[model samples]
Target: MVVANDEGGVKPSHGGPAVADAAPQVDHGMLALTLGALGVVYGDIGTSPIYAFREALVASSGGNVAEREDILGVLSLIIWALTIIVTIKYILFVLRADNKGEGGTLSLMALARGAFAHRPRWILLLGMLGASLFYGDAVITPAISVLSAVEGLNVVTPTFEPYVVPLTLVILAAVFAVQRFGTASVASVFGPVTALWFLSIGASGVVHIVDDPEILLAINPVYIVYFLANSPEVAFVTIGAIFLAVTGAEALYADLGHFGRRPIVLAWLAIVFPCLLLNYVGQGAFVLSHGGIVGHPFFEMNEGWALLPMVALATAATVIASQAVISGAFSLTRQAVQLNLLPRLEILHTSETQSGQIYMPRVNMLLGIVVFMLVIGFQESTNLAAAYGISVTGNMLMTTLLLAVVMLKIWKWPLVAVVALTSMFAVIDIGFFVSNIVKVLDGGWASLAIAFTMALIISTWMRGSRYLFEKTRKNEMPLGFLTEQLAKKKPQLVPGTAVFLTGDPLSAPTALLHSLKHYKVLHEQNVILSVVTAQQPKVPDQERARIEKLNDLFMRVTVTFGYMEQPNIPRALAICRKQGWKFDIMTTSFFLSRRSLKASPTSGMPLWQDKLFIALAKSASDATEYFQIPTGRVVEIGTQVAI
Candidate 1:
């Protein structure tokens, strides 16, 4: 039997047991977290200098050699993009919308949902769109990051050009292959290695900036305006490429729970931002000095003696960038499953101490296959770059819309202030979205296709699950009335406790009804147990389980877990033991209803959708394994249902 836990109405009351406090500020380990943030949170954006500047300049010049103005203009666009989008909008504003120290699309959705007395459907749809877009980003990041880095070999020697794709595939395969072994052993060096990369790239930029001091003029925002006014058509295309520089900016907000706001902000300002700026300016300076020829400027800027070493370092940095995105995919999928957006996939913990270290075989395999196809199809970083930015731009627009609700309702900001802020962000977001939209025929459709597929799956699962719940609830007897009738007429009482798992605690479980019909007997003790997923990230131990004694013969228990947590039925029931329920696993038999669903023409959805839902239901992981319940103690009651 596979059942998704209810994700609503699990919030503890103010008078109830205290919830866990927000993660405390680790002042003592601030340096460690700052370094860690640079490695993980900044890896994606940090690696962008390798291709972002070159692409923008090339786009601005329209395949011809760039003029002095084009070089300065492209650099200016990249600079302000980082400033307004990453620095001002995300790090300054969106990070403040965190839901109890957790920041992500869904976390912000939960916060916005709670701000009002009643939840709004538009807010939920916005969150789903944002999350679905992230899956598109997840698929593209590894492909572009690694390909761009490996393409550096072409600069080292034309002899390596023929081998670039083969070499890239091998490296990408190894990256996904290592996911099962976990990142703990190698994570310690992520900080140091990435730190060195920043220093090297920064120093390289310093050398060229010294040679051509005039390139510093790009730091002014005026050049961006001048660039746009000079040629609107070319500038629009350049803006699309410039958006690449800020593609990973969302990671800064998504990883807020892992490293506190202070460390991430500090890391960007002190290290990541400055280094990226220098490298980009250096690339510009090199191009300008070489008469506006932009041929892999990032690699060509370095001296011949340093070229091979730089390529090696670039490859390692790209791998780290890919690792961060892959891990984020795993984390996001877990949140989706707990919230019932996706079916439960088998999750294996890689680290005993760190609950966040998880491996999902299905997600990993699927990502790997798609990534390989992308590499083979695109065959060049330049082509893959054409497909990037659409998803990130769409996601950014959704975040802006959702953040407006949080600002006006939760923060109690003046509506005027909220509108102005959202309008400013919306303008930038829409511009980027349109710019990328024009690239749909130039490979951007791949991302849109992936995102559309994911959104359809999420919507279908939600609708089908709701229809099943309503249908099941309509036929089942009320728990209150059923227990009353059973108390009045005594039956042969068994010795062990029989716990029936159900989504709707008010309605009697199907397993319980079938058990009584077949055996014509009742257990000495009965537990109506329901597992609930809270809106928050983690529920405290004191508020984990809520118990009520309906009568002497039956007791009701609702065990709550946060969306970020795994549900372990046995461990949760242990909490009931301490609350004087005398719960014993050895003397208990869990009753679960295993439904075999058949598709009907007259169902809530279309014929094909009904079949899809039935397939999804069958593919779901076993309830006994998913809930961490022992196999020997579980009793499955089979039932047939049409949906």
Candidate 2:
């Protein structure tokens, strides 16, 4: 049975400690967390007003008169989409399926996958596709968000038109460059600036919304239903754009662990939802008064004097949102590495106190390259819209499918409740997915291409890892046999503890056996250490380490860390002291086996895939640094593997 970390973590099904879900008392701590969630979690949806409405209206009118019905219908669709997709489906439903209080596509997958010891491997395929889609979204978010924000300069004068793309490229380069400093340093300012952004947009919308109060009629569901009934073709095309309003809905769940469910939910209900509603309404009002301001309805809503200031705030807000997605990608990569779906990557912990704040140089550099290319290539937010819609919608659909498994199999909800809820979600999600599918020829193919490439890499890595595990195990001797032979050999007893790091706890580590063969010496105490990544996001300190005596001189030590956590073998070993095992930091030596992977024609995988696997392993970060082991006390043994 699984148990979750207690207090700030989730409780496992095996009656482990649970993070409290009780409402916090009125305090600055609670308010600060809520405000922080506002800045990070809602930035994408918050900035959607800059482009979503204009794009949808353009699709609806098709350059004809922007009739009142068309404006109201699009507005009505945007309103209800946000309500059901973001508010009900995500915040209320998917967030509850979190793994140890961590919610994301991979976390949800781990939680569901952990519930069954045996199941079809195809289930993992869905999770991989979701993660791949997230990468596509990551590349698009910064490009579209910054491009749309900078496009506001066009309203001030025609002079800024030619320079928009160049300016956006400069801003993106600087933003990616600062990722190494970590979010903790900048998050304090992000919250307040975002708060101001919401206030300004709400007030801006209020100005137009009050003048044309008739636009408020769009909030009624009748307009949406009637519009679709009367003009099915128009409604179908328009909704492909309307889906933009809730594009960042998954962020609410993906970022749940950062601020907790209470803070994220509070931020949405109290701040984000209201402002987004107002801005959308204001856009509708502007469209009604001025027909077909399709290319620039959002900017046109602002008064002339306020245009420049609003543009500046918008650029800052979009930068903040883009940073949020990049950081999420780093976290996702680390989790994938720990789960063995991907090869190990170099992970740098940026914040001393916050484990969640990290920087991945490889991921950062790759994202920077892709984002810059997109900004220059796409050149306009309208063109990038098709690609953005496909990525986000695909991710949303994947979440729904994964949540169906969680609801029926993991959470054990009633069959009727499960069927009804998933069916409703499926209809809406499938509609959005289908609408975006038509745009594949119009740059929507970009997201699909990224997803397919990543899925292939991930699957190949998993398969390669399994093959190596089996190949190595075929030569490994059991611990009992090793101990028996060692007693008979009577090798020289060394002075201190020797810890052998092994991938498999059941078999003898290659390093330990190699040491005996080469030097014919054994330590006074031999500790077989295996660092296991748990399926949960975090394993509590109390349950982190387990110790068992294999014999008088040999002991089996397994240290468990959550996929979200950084592994430190030294720190984990210290926990064994309470269990009657004395661990000394000064004299202990860590033995690590480094494999030299060779691509073979007869390898289980195709020759090209074998080469790809070798390249990934060669670039993988060193195990000693990854496990936080001291360099001075580490020994490396090399092995050749043809897989």
Candidate 3:
């Protein structure tokens, strides 16, 4: 889970206490939070008007001049997509399914897993798939958003056309480049700037809306029925483009932990929803007045003076949208690492006070490269658009499936109610997914490929980790056996304390056994330490450590951290001090085993996958750095392992 810190940093999830359902006492803090929601939570959906309406109209009309009915039909679809998908499904229902005040794909998966008596394999698979698809969305969002925004230059003048892709690449590069500096300062302005964006778009929308008041009638659901019935095939194709309107709807739920449900709901209803509705409707109005000509209606609707400013504002808004998505990927990556779905990567906390403000250089570099390739390959926003909706739709479908389990098992909702709610969402999700599926040859394959590759990596890492743990356990002595023998044949005793970090506490760590074999001595104070990741987002201090005394010669210490937290061994060991364990860093030496893994054909996974897992293992971050242990007080033992 990615948590947003109280400093208003743009992390994936919020680490602050969950906001109450009751209206917060109106204050500058609450106001600031609401504004922040506008920027980070709603940024992606807020900017959809730039291409959603135009693309739907173009797809419906088959690239020729659009008919009046086609314009109204596409407008009605876009409006209702937002209403049903974003408003009712996400804002009303999905936001309510948060996990302990936290919300995101993995958070929901963790919640759903706890609902069962035993952890189900399918639930884990679903979570992995959802997270993988999110990475796909992460890459595509920046590419499509920036490209579409820069394409607005063509509306300024055809002379600016050649520079659109190059300029977009520069802007995107800058966005990714600055991620190393962190988003704390940049996040401060995200809300205000995004709020201005909403106001500007809303104002432009109202101007054209007044010119053709008849466009208001598109709000009726009857138009959608008529439009679909009249041209079923066109409607099918248009639904994929119409899905662009709600592509970021998942963010509403994903960011539920960040800004809270009330702020997100309020931001959407008061600002984002209204602004998007007006702009989409106004684009329809503008198209109707021009005899159903729909060439860049979002840009054309703004006449001479307003067009340039709108383009500039639109570009800024898209960059913000891209930023939010990239940050989300970082957060999700951390969650995967904690959950043991992926290999450990270097995680750098950007803020001292805010644990949520993190930067993964490897993740940032990978995203930037993929996004650049997308821009170079697609060359136009319309082409990139063809690749966008599939990942988002697939992710939404996975969410719905997981949510049904939550509703039935966790919330204890009636079977009928859970089925009814999920079926409605599943139908909508399936429609959008199937529509996008038809465009597989038209660039949709890119998102699928990315998702598939990520899923494979996650699955391989998980399987490999499990295999290595079990195989290593088979070769280790039980802690009870080791301590009993030590008590009978006491070796030369060292004066200071020694901590052996291992995944399993029941067995003696490899480091401990190697120490006895090489030096023929044991420390006076020996601790068998295991770091455990809890299912919850943040474990309380009271429950952070569990101490078990095995005998005078051995003790077991377990430190628990929430998946959202960074493991600081010293800080956690300090908690042990309260439990009568004298954990002085100066006198304590940490022991760790460094594995040299080699692939064997007899291992469970395929040969290629075994190699991949070994490669991933090699790339994993150093244990001392990851666990925040002091380097000077750590000793490493090497071992050979086959998997």
Candidate 4:
């Protein structure tokens, strides 16, 4: 079940308040489904304990300090960081920012667009920036999540140390290899596996807590306060590390359409939160007793009989994390296409049962290459950690800002409460954001590079679209104006009927320009056929076909349909035949303007970016086969255009 946000450009009516076939069921079966969803979707955030604690400890030391205080301070930071960002901010606050009960970057963007299309342009920029940052996070997530999981192998066995990189690569390869197959059937196991994984983490922590109950004192906010107040400089760096704990929290919002709000929220509150708290507590206890083992404290928490199960659970959790991001990339691409940031692609729904299980080959191949490169480039999970947290933090900050606008303008929440709550989040988000800025030169550039590239593409597409629309609107003739002239200029020449298919519904299409330029004669009877693709999934066949007469010569026609649907122009002709529409197929030439977009300065994009967009357009372009236009009767007129 995947419910699109019922806000945004071309909002599709999906029945009434609750859409049919949206949001996967909430039941015992879903409990199992939530595991897999949690496993893959929640993997990045869930497995942060593997390295967050270690990095915070290192940052706290600043290369010189007592290992005990460093361990305690770092552990306290991770625990409280999770409590504030995940439990309070995301779980308690941000989750409430749903767009017609749908969540995610796309959902949020849709909500903003619907409410603020006529508002200041800065609001749209914020929405796009958040979307761009999400794409950046998508690229880095798999790299860090799998790397962290494989790093655990080194902690358990010395022989496994040297093979961590290769093993992580292998695991990633296997995860991506199965993406085309879809996860509906196999997803049943995700909930149980993740459930056991979190439970095991909690149980392990309880054992350590039993041994050293005094470590529980770190849970108080005062310890976090003390660490921040006493070590302001070093604590800034800890902001970078603490962000790792909530890396996958965005997935909770992004994939909210999959499991619905209730199941996901319940799963997070009931199962995921408690286990995560326990694991952090156990790590704190382990750090308190044996602060000497500073390199990988998470691995040190387990010993003897427990180490092997811990290893197994961590690996399973890592798989879940990787899968979540992969699925997220697909959904994001889908949204991109719908919103026109991306060109059309072959979007294949993997499951007849679950519409959310989608497969995009171009996206999958690209992301797989990038993830594999990150694995080999970083060579270790710990190294990749530098690049991971910054993008997630940036995205979180973007979300907080966008939600403020939503609360005040859309939901009409009181300005004071929205400002106060958003300000608190802004302070925390900015602190983490500033901390991650220091990591820009230290492997953080990868995520930044990705963000920059995506932003460039999105911005270019948006600007180019505006330019194209403005240019067309200014130059092209409106249907009513053209029809009025046609009635007076060529009353004697009107004998046969001619239908011209147009790209734009508002103005006379480029196809008509090419047709009039090539052929000097005008037909007595003229029809302007414009197709309007609704954002909805289905349009009734009858309602999809509409015909209106323009003056006496021009027939203004429109076929309202969906991108997912197959157009039946021949059947449409059959219906028109009954109305005595003179059926002369041979002379009725269907014109289509094929613009040859150039990668030059005139395209309103950099040369490289123009080339990238052109290449993406070519790769994702729709084939002529699906449009139902006649093979021989259609003529494509080529025009070299800069856009």
Clash count per candidate: 0, 2, 5, 7
Report clash pairs, candidate 2. 3-12, 4-12
By lDDT, is 1 or 4 better? 1
Listed per candidate, the RMSD to the true structure in angstroms reads 4.8, 4.9, 4.9, 6.2
List runs of model 4 lying over 4 Å from the truth.
Answer: 1-37, 63-66, 117-119, 472-475, 485-503, 513-591, 599-613, 623-635
Clashes (candidate 2): 2
Judging by lDDT against the true structure, name the best candidate.
3
Off by over 4 Å in 3: 1-25
Q: Rate residue 290 of model 4 by lDDT.
A: 64
Off by over 4 Å in 1: 1-28
2 or 4: which has the higher lDDT?
2
Kindly report the root-mean-square deviation of model 2 from the true structure over all alpha carbons: 4.9
Local distance difference test, candidate 1? 0.86
Give the distance in Å from residue 153's predicted Cα in candidate 1 to where it truly belongs: 0.5
TM-score of each model, paired residue for residue: 0.96, 0.94, 0.96, 0.84
lDDT of 2 by residue, 416-445 (tens): 999999999989998998888898988898
Better of 1 and 4 by TM-score: 1
